[model samples]
Target: MSGRAAAEKSGAMTGANEFKLTQGPEDSVSAVKFSPSSAQFLLVSSWDCTVRLFDVSANSMRMKYQHLAPVLDCAFYDPAHAWSGGLDNQLKTHDLNTDQDTIVGTHDAPIRCVEYCPEVNVMVTGSWDMSVRLWDPRTPCNAGTFTQPEKVYTLSVAVYTLAVFQLSVSVFQLSVSVFQLSGCVSAECLVRLALVMLTRCVCFQGYVLSSIEGRVAVEYLDPSLEVQKKKYAFKCHRLKENGIEQVFPVNAISFHSVHNTFATGGSDGFVNIWDPFNKKRLCQFHRYPTSIASLAFSTDGSLLAIASSYMQEQGDVSHPADAVFIRQVTDAETKPK
Candidate 1:
């Protein structure tokens, strides 16, 4: 379907204003991130081996840069700089102001996630090599590398805290580990959310982890046994057909910066907002043409950028073209009742 048609379908379902970008990545869009300070600019990384910065307010691609291989993830270090890594096994920093690119470092395996932690003033990259490496954004040097129990599938930052999902799909295992990147250069595991299933994506609003089995865990950042008791898991994105149950992986998640509520996107092509405090779903947007690969809420929580792309989680198959939909969100859709 065309971008406009998809937007119409989505807008009708949630009653939220929506539009499609005039241009999008050539291949599957791996990630969509809004700037830390402003919502007008969005950073997108794709399997096309390029990262593009889009001026969402104007619906135009402002700048783009290429990588040797597919770019898996990208994050805005600040308004002027972006950090990205992917199949090339290399980490790169791009100066948005000058449009210059520099190779920072390399990982043994493909990098899956890139995140900037402002509180600690550090850049973090997670990889399939089973390690999380820290880089000093100012100096452009590797500060430290910490090993994980399994391959790092996703990483989320909440203040000085970093939440990492160590996943092993073959055995259906997952470890939700939290690291405090404060005083020391090396990271220390503050807490583990217990061994679960294969985790496809995670977002921090008190550290939320979603698995491939259509289950999501909401846990608190505080490691105290009492606060841990408040943590719970719920099943979603599952359908029953002909008495058989089919579960889709929750591929992406983003939290509303203002409301503290969150949205989850799944391979089922659906996105839903939830009130974690109330354990209720606020609303579910209309399904897209294909899988929902990534999601990002603008800084002030007035906008949400959704990437509908094919993840190939079921292996290579026919699917719709990749697209990014920018929706004007409201308190009714994001704010908890």
Candidate 2:
């Protein structure tokens, strides 16, 4: 970890507050997200090829949309207009007001992740085909396409950069005119570390990457080498036994919008709140029974959604069902100890 981060994390610690159990999909939930306009509204994408809309305030499913294949990831461009990507490799927009669906673009392989950059009026999708393509919803046409050496497993959008990464553990930065990739985090080391960074989100100037290796890297997007030197990673979600680290993969990461503090969920079934500035966990969240596949904070950061699913780590799921958890967040959760 960087000295800057170490200096910041020295004085903070938090406890994971419990989660409010909510009914979810009959199948393993792939992602859990809150609406950009309001925290009361949430969405859950499942391997069952369905997306369920829930009224969190009411604790009821509001509407359900089914696709041709399992839905992998989704994002809202706005309250009424949103997009969903699935195993079908198709990106489609769903109109919440009318409940209508429309195709936006296509990927050669399953669309593992999608992100909306409201400032640029563009949508980005990462795929198994090893490409990241930009789409302009206004024209229903692709703005541009960029290829990577490995399968693109996740995508995230910041003010000036688009992050595309693969499970092999590399991140790429894409812009409208210039695209650059910082030094790759060695895949072998990542594998040895065993953190599966399948889910990631843009925080501010940097992106938070979680790994199955039991570490989460705080990476800088800047192309300059000196600034890049400031980037560092920390080990979390692990245990000490015989002085050997029994690390659990950090399966999910979500950044709070207002505070910039992020939350991490892991195979250990625990979710923790962190202040990247301090580079320390501010609080720990209630643990679950299964691995956390995804995490999302509402636009206002008033609510947090956690999804527990079959991560393929346990072979066959004994219960064969997924769960959803939403917790109302308070400022105290992120307060430095």
Best by the TM-score measure: 1
Across residues 47-66, which tens digit of lDDT does each residue of candidate 2 receive?
A: 98988887776666778888
lDDT of 1 by residue, 1-337 (tens): 5333554554522334778776689999999999998988999999999999988777778999999999999999999999999999999999999999999999999999999988888899999999999999888899999999888988988778888988785775768888888742778888886664778777887778888889998978766899988899999998789999999999988999889999999999999999999998999988887899999999999889999999998788888989888888888998899
Q: Candidate 1 — which residues are off by over 4 angstroms?
A: 1-16, 169-173, 223-225
Task: State the C-alpha lDDT per candidate.
Answer: 0.88, 0.71
RMSD list, candidates in order: 3.5, 9.7
Task: State candidate 2's TM-score.
Answer: 0.81
Worst 10 residues of 2 by lDDT: 184-193
**Over the full model, what C-alpha lDDT does candidate 2 score relative to the true structure?**
0.71
Give the TM-score of each candidate.
0.92, 0.81
Among these predictions, the greatest lDDT belongs to 1
lDDT of 1 at 240: 84
